[model samples]
Target: MNWQPAKKQNDYVQTRNKNFSPPTVNQVLQNAQKMIGPISESPRLDAQVLLAKIMKNSRTWLVAHPKSRLGAQEDVQYRRLVARRAHGEPLPYILGTWEFFGRRFQINPSVLIPRAETEHLVEEALGLLRNNRSVLKVLEVGTGSGCIAVSLLLEMRSLGVVATDISLQALRTAAQNIVNHAIGDRIDLVQTDLFSGIRGQFDLVCANLPYIPRKVLNNLQVGRWEPRLALDGGEDGFIYLRRFIAEVAKVLAPGGSVVLEIGEGQDEEVRSMIRLGFPRAPVRISKDLAGYNRVVVFET
Candidate 1:
């Protein structure tokens, strides 16, 4: 399943015939569209992104310089990236970075690529902490790319977060983001199974834990490239959710809040689990812009 540029002389000959002259940005977009249109939802946009990456320029620049020609090396790299995307590797993975919560973070197959839906989780947490200016400590379970934790640290000056993940590789990705954002001193990255090695209480505990059922994951395009530890939520997609509810009480400060990103249609079930786990805590679910239940927040 290696995805590299076609290397055979015959392949090169065919490419040479197809591209007699160096490809202009517009021609490359058309080529990418033809190659990936069947699998990609927005083939033109995907082409623009890939070309932008190759040219080390912005998408806006691509749009303005459609007549500009790609160098030989640039054309080869663009084709290789397009081939990778056409084969189901995520665009963010191919680009090696993704924007989340208005900031860019380094990403790879080792961690789940941060999604726009997860931004709701960050917003909900920020809303809860807005008026509380006092020094706040937060615990983030399953800090994939550290997007949630780092975004929080950036938005809330009084906040400090301890982020944990079972995958050492994921922690490394998060670590790079921490340094990139200059939040290295504010975040502590630990490798442990959901709160196993964590200590102490915090003003808030948040997680975008794996909530996709094993069966459901098999059908997802994302399942092909993302780490299973970051996507598999066991048989019912609540295995980790239930476990977090069971153990979070120990490290959650009194009056501390917990926010989580849940899969679609699991809102009521997750809220019920929260009630059962912490009968005294108040629970509520928040929907994303499209109105799907996306985040669950509770206070102990």
Candidate 2:
């Protein structure tokens, strides 16, 4: 349980291999199976990933060489990662990078961590872009970690994107992802809240703004580690959604669409507000894998 700076990477890896405690692969698998559905649903897979990361090897390589002894440094690193995971730290934060939409994205504490639900937004957006193959102007509000924006750019490399965030720190992190992904020239990162500093009309506007009510945020599991600005959505949690609906009409191109990631139980209200604000804007609700209404699309 004691944390220490890694003396040497390989030394840590070796220690993890020798001190894993589980007697056999089956034992390790059993322990992982038991851990799943409690803290993390993918405990078995997470174990392999954490072990592979510590071993500085691919997941396939780790699977192929599970019994291969780790060097001293690799063992220590594996134990450190496991200990962190045993607490509540996310695996992506520990690995420092996560795969999103078939591409690698660097993640840090500066921005809200990306989630699977948000990927639904990406899927819907891509569907929209595919339907309209023309070069499109896209804007992503609250582009934390640039996960959504970067993924869009990577998915639709030919389009131009403008990604905005209220936090300079988040923008910095997002900018890094842009550059790292080699899409620096294709997308722009602006430091602004919503579309305050943005100009012109975009064919599509995407926002995954904070939608957690101030009251509920404190009790949410995500509130423990994520930035409050990314979760606290005022008293009712629809403050930002309402405001976005009000202002988006002015900035949206004729026949353009707006994609929003909504919070649980707020989809109906959000869709209603979007309709009331932009009566001409066609509003539709989309659900996630869990069958929750998680995305709202507004066509102007």
Give the top-scoring candidate (TM-score).
1
lDDT (0 to 1) per candidate: 0.88, 0.79
lDDT of 2 at 18: 50
lDDT of 1 by residue, 30-101 (tens): 878787787889888888888898999999999999899988678777878898888878888998999999
Which parts of model 2 have CA positions greater than 4 angstroms off?
1-38
Clashes of 2: 21
Tens-digit lDDT track of model 2 for 39-64: 78688787788776665677787667
* Candidate 2, residue 38: how far the Cα is off, in Å: 6.5
Query: Which candidate comes out best when scored by lDDT?
Result: 1
RMSD of each: 3.0, 4.1
| Per-prediction TM-score to the true structure, in the order listed | 0.94, 0.85
